[model samples]
Target: MFDSYSISELGSIFVMQGFAGLILFSVYLLMALGLAIIFGQMGVINMAHGEFMILGAYVTYFTSQAFQHFLPALFPAYFFVAMALAFVASGTLGMIVEWGLIRHLYKRPLDTLLATWGLSLILQQVYRSVFGPREVGVELPAWMMGSLKLTDTIEVQINGLFVMTLTVIITAVVAVMMFRSRWGMQVRAVVLNRMMASAVGINTERVDRLTFGIGCGIAGVAGSAFTMIGSTGPTAGQLYIVDTFLVVVFGGAQSLIGTILSALSISQTQSTLEFFLSGSIAKVITLLGVVGILMLRPQGLFTLKVRR
Candidate 1:
């Protein structure tokens, strides 16, 4: 039923599609950035990353309920508080998991993968038991529930803009921490050469825990943001895991810059394709393209100089 439209109509469709792509890019970046840090810097395969994200979403849900019940006056501001709480909740869980399990598996990356995969299953079941099998709807404040119309046919949702802004702020903050701070120097040193860094008196273990926690924390924030645009279920995080991994792997696991680039490229490509084809078909084509490119350049779009 679809056909070519007038110039004005075509322009409106393109604008709407581009904005949609931007929202998708922001979510993908958030999901990939955390995995990039843990996998690239610490060499730990956190297969449970998606579960950590779900933890954040659940935290936000509860935060909203609390605000609605006890602080009705602050209901409009629940999202900010929810975001902060989600970070802390997910980060704390990450720290505990690191101390309890991941710390011992640092020397065994493959083993960590299997362990975290099992942990992910455990977390999923726990969420199902606690929250039930149905998806819970997160209540967005009225301010975030509408759209901004650029023209009669062109409109952008406020929530999408909020997510895009959040992504930009998070990316800038992370870039600063990675490139400008002394801790960032230590993190890079550890990533480049763990034994050498340890020999130089760097507390590599501390760095590892912190890096993992930060990664999980970011995932939480992402999950919280995602509730605005997607369903929130016990298994909602699973839906994004594949795409998140695709972005991180295709972007180059060791580079945040690569992660952002990969997310944008993939999101834009998928969005454009989705406008023409069914979502399932678009995804299939996009994935096949990614696989073909990866087969040609196994190291991904970017690679660090360090030998692994």
Candidate 2:
């Protein structure tokens, strides 16, 4: 990998690839944040999480089409509306799923996993029925189409920067909501001790529903962000679910900071490696490294110490 390129050329390649890694990091963090909430905090193996993300993608596509058809003048600002709608749509459906399916499967991780996997298939078929078998992409505004010329050799996409910005804002909001807010305290309380929380006047059921909804909502936002880089298909979400789950598990389920750090590490590693090797080889190496580390440190990179 090194013999063909001079030092200066290598420097530029590293810079460009590092930025690509950063964008990949942003996506992993965004997706893992929601997985952390659902699987890490709530202990639900939601295989259908990706479908929720695809739902948001479809919603964004329709939003873009509608804006282009009916509100062309204000099209640049349509993404904001699309994001909000994606969150609402995914979250509402999540709450309904939690109520209709997940709630009954509490304490049965295997059952939840199988059920959600089935749900993922159902959702995929539904998407195919509604959107047809073809993949669709949203039309970005003119402003998002260009790149920032940082230097002679390094340019970054405006849309990539936009996605990273959204990830940071959403991550900050999630951190505050999980740590500083009153409702956050209630959620932690319930997670730590559901019986005690219920005795103390917390509505555990409502908390569960809202937490799941918020997780799904964040996934939706991720899918909306994804439209910037890739087209959306019925099976697209499935491509990322395993990676997202690995991120959550490798981070330590109970630690939010762990989640962020792990996502960054895994994404940057796989991304940079992909530049030097085939994509499949890069992924194999990344997975092997994660699994090897996990074998040694079963509790993950960080674990919260809590009394039983």
Candidate 3:
């Protein structure tokens, strides 16, 4: 990998790859954050989580189309509207699923997994039927189409930077909501002791429903960001599902800080390696590294001590 490159070339490669990794990191972090909340707090292994993401992508696609057809003057500003709608659409579906399907399966992790998996299949078919079986790409605004030249050999994508900024804002908001707000405190209490929380006037069921909704909503935002990087398809969400799970599990599912760190490390390592190696090879190497670390410390890189 190093044989043909000079010192300057290597530096440029690192810089460019590092930037690309940051974009990937943003996407992974967004997806994992939502999964962490649902899996860690609610103890629900939602296999259909990716479908929720793709739902958001489809929402964005349609939103862009509508804007182009009827609101061309506002096309550049359509993304914000699309993201909001995506969150609502996905989150509403999450809440409904919780009320109709997931609530009955509490304490049954395997059942939740199987149920959500079936739900995923249903959602994929629905998307295929509704959106057609073709992969669709979003039309980005002019402002997000260019790159900033940092050096002769290193340039940063404007859309990548936008996604990173969006990730930062979302992460900060989640942290504040998780740690400082009254509802966040209630969520923690429910997670630590659901029976006690219910006994003490906290609506455990409501918390569970809202928490799941928020998680899926975040995934929706992730899907919105994803459109900037890749095409959207009925099956596209599946591609990131496994990797998102790896990030969540390897980061300590309950710890937001851990999720961020894990996403950054995994994305950067894979991004850098993919430049020199095949994409599959890079992923295999990354997965092996994560497995090795997990074998040594099964609790993950960071964990919060809670009563068993």
Candidate 3: Cα lDDT at 195:
94
lDDT, candidate 3, 257-277, per-residue tens: 899999999999999999999
- Using lDDT, give the best candidate's number: 3
Flag clash pairs in model 1: none
Q: Per-model C-alpha lDDT, please? A: 0.89, 0.91, 0.94
- Give stretches of model 3 more than 4 Å off: 306-308
Model 2's alpha-carbon lDDT is 0.91
TM-score of each: 0.95, 0.98, 0.98
lDDT by residue (tens digit), candidate 1, 1-308: 24667878878877888889999999999988888888877888888999999999899998999999999999999999999999999998999999999999988888999999899999999999998889987889999989998889989999999999999999888889988998888999998889999999999989888888888999999989988888778888888888988998899888888889999989988997798789999899999999998999788898868555
Model 1 TM-score (2 dp): 0.95
Which pairs clash in model 3?
none
- Candidate 2: where are CA atoms >4 Å away? 306-308
Residue 308 CA error for candidate 1 (Å)? 11
